[model samples]
Target: MDLDAEFKLDDDLCYLNHAAVAPWPLRSMQAVERFARENAMRGAAHYPRWMEVENTLRENLARLINAPSPRDIALVKSTSEALSFVAYGLHWEPGDEIVISDQEFPSNRIVWESLADQGVTVRVVSLDGDDCEDDLIDAFNNNTRLLAISSVQYGTGLRMNLDKLGAACKAAKVLFCVDAIQSLGALPLDVEKSQIDFTMADGHKWLLGPEGLGVFYVRPALRESLKLHEFGWHMIANRGDYRQTTWQVAPDATRFECGSPNTMGAHAFQASTELLLEIGIDKVEALVLNRVELLERELNKIQGIEILSSRDRQRQSGILTFRVAHQDSQALYRDLMSRNVICASRGGGARFSPHCYTPDAVIHTAVERLAECIS
Candidate 1:
């Protein structure tokens, strides 16, 4: 596929904020427009077809993450909703412990922290040491009920070794949950191989889709362990059989989705995921990493610029965060935005996250603009 034809970014603007909300691809936009037109013209006349798109989306997400089956996937409004499902669904005893890293995003942090009322202790481990994985794994004890961590730290762009953490969790008999918003589309993720009990990611970020739709993956065996907190017709096993009075909860991840599906979001994200699959995630990872490398190299040459993100290749991700020495990060962020360099101010630095489709010219131009702005 000709990627240039797919991404129609403006010439004057350089988008380097895929870690935040990403601009939708052409196909996703087209899909949304088509869905809108159909809704306006026919008014639910094509509802069945929309459900088909939703199912296809689940399959695409399953394949993207190498999930065992589409049955393991649930379409949710956001990553927060999915996390809440696991958070409230599980039976937490007083004094039970949950292990998480200190660098987690608010969505990942707040959800776990909110369980304090139930006497559940949230252990926040620092990932600043040489042996970060060991630091996290060592935090687990007999009381540790689960370990929740991001696949990549959002602000620092530090990619965690999920395999190591997953293995440690498995050995410790601890449930593993991953907030994969940062790495899901830019990198390959295997739930089964990594032994992840639960995982969730929003579509608006690296997936290059619209907001209000995300994926939640729950391992098959542990599906029933989570008590159902929400109930509706959609979550019933006999969903189509409205006449059936005796309805059982869905045998799959759909049990988490207690209401109507986001048909429009499903259409948009399905197109986006299809684009990512067509390009191949391996190729996407390579392209994104190459861009990150280029940004890192260019930033390194400029004086007074301190790269905040990890330099280690294994820890590096699509995010490259840095700061100009002796400068306020927010001020620099504003200056960059003024220059049409779309990035973010995070972790005490300016964060630039380029996607696989980001052009070389954009990276070079953004770097040159940074140099000029600081000079």
Candidate 2:
């Protein structure tokens, strides 16, 4: 497949900010166009077909994370909403501690911290030094109820050893929640293999879809244990039987999805994920890692440049963060944007995150522009 054609970004621009909002693929745009056209002409007359598409999207998501079944997936509004579902769903007692990394994105950190009024303690562990996994697991104690962390640290692109941590969570009998927004599409994630209890991700970043739609995966055994805060007709077991005044909650993850679905976003996200599966996650991961490696190599050639992300290749994700000596990171970010080298300022440096479909020439040109800014 012509991967570059999928993006077809402007020739003058070097778009490398997949860590932020990503540009949609041509296929996704076409899918959205078809969905809009159908809505304009037929309205919900073809609602059944739209439902089929939504179901397919759910299956695609289940495959993306190797979910046990499509029934385990819930269509959510955003990562924060999913995190909230988990944070408040569980019954917490005073003095219960939640373990988290110091480098978590606010979505993963704030939800736990917000429980302060209930006397839940949020233990922030630093992911520094050689044995980051040991640091986190070592912090676990009898009072530790759950551990919430990002699969990949947002700022430094640090890829955690999920297997090790999952084992620890299992042995400790603590709940495991993963904020997968940064790593979902760029790498392969198996909820089963990792023994993850809960995981959520928004499709707008590396997934190459729009905002306002995400996926929440809950383990089957714990489904009923999580008390529901949101409720609607759609969440009823007999959803079609509106005349029946009595209702029971749906016996699957759909219990979390209490209202109408974002059919348009589902169409777009489905197309994007279909493209990724066709390309295969393992292949996509190899391609993504290759791009990060290329960025590190090229940036190292620039005098006085410092790679802010972890130098360990095993810990690197699709993101490559760096800084130039004596240059203000924000100043460089604004300058790069002005020149159309799209990226973000993160962790006291500018972050360039390219998807697997990003062209090598774009990567080279992006680094070249950053070098020019420093010089």
Candidate 3:
């Protein structure tokens, strides 16, 4: 695939915010367009084909995360919904505890914390220590029922040692869950290697797809342990057999999908997922980190710009956050937006997250635009 041709962004725009919402590649956009046209003219005549696309997406997602099978993947509305599945479905004891990092996105934190009514404790461990992974591992005791953390922190872009954490969780017999939105498309993730019991990520971010669609993975052995709170025709083993008098809940992860599928979102997300898989995650991670490195180098050259993200190679991600001496982060963000430097105001600074396809010239231009924002 011609990488440059896939992303035909505007000449004046420097898109450096893939960590938030990524613009879809041409193929993905075209897939949506084709779906729209087919819906208009052909109607449900192409329904079976659409189902195939959705199933393919599940397989692709399984491949992306190295899940045991596509049966482990559930198409979800968003990461929040998947998190809710675990939050409400589980039978929690009054004194049970869930371990999480302090820097989790609200989707990960708020859901777990909301379980306080059930007398569950949300243990927020500080990742500020020299060895953040160890800090998390140490937080786990007999009371800890689960450990939920992001594969990469949203603001500071600190990549966690998931394998080490996973191993610890397995040994401690705690459920390992990861909010993988920030790292899924840009970095390679293996649920098996990491011993993750549950994981979810939206397609809009690094996946280069639209909103309203995401992937949820639940370990097969623990599937029934999470009692389902949502029920509908689609989640049944006899799905589509509207005339049947008896029904059984799906035997696989599809049991979590309680309603009609997002067919349009599925088409586009599958296209985007296939594109990333074609490029290969290891190659994508390398290219993404290279862009971040360039951003760090260029941003450092400007006067009074202080890099806030980690410099450790293991901890580094596509995100590079920085702030100016006298400027407020939001003010700098607005200024950059006015200058057509597409970035985000986060981590108490301006965050620039470029994908694998981001050009070096765009990275340099974004840094130059930031200089203007401060100057």
Q: What is the C-alpha local distance difference test score of each model?
A: 0.94, 0.92, 0.93
Error at 192, model 3, angstroms: 0.6
lDDT of 2 by residue, 1-375 (tens): 888678777899999899999999999999999999989998999999998988999999999999999989999999999999999999999999999999999889999999999999999999986899999999999999998989998897999999899999999999999999999999999999999999999999988888999999999999888999999988879798989988899998899999999999999999999999999999999999999999999999999989889988789899888888888889999999999999999977999899998888998898888878887
RMSD of 1: 0.8
Q: TM-score for every candidate vs. truth?
A: 0.99, 0.99, 0.99
lDDT of 3 by residue, 281-360 (tens): 99999999998888888888998988889999999998888888887899899999999999899888989899999999
Residue 139 of candidate 1: its Cα lDDT?
91
- Candidate 2 minimal-lDDT segment of 10 residues: 1-10
Query: In model 2, how large is the Cα lDDT of residue 83?
Result: 98
- Candidate 3 worst ten-residue window by lDDT: 366-375
Encode model 1's per-residue lDDT on 74-116: one tens digit a residue: 9999999999999998999999999999999999989999999
Output the TM-score of candidate 2: 0.99
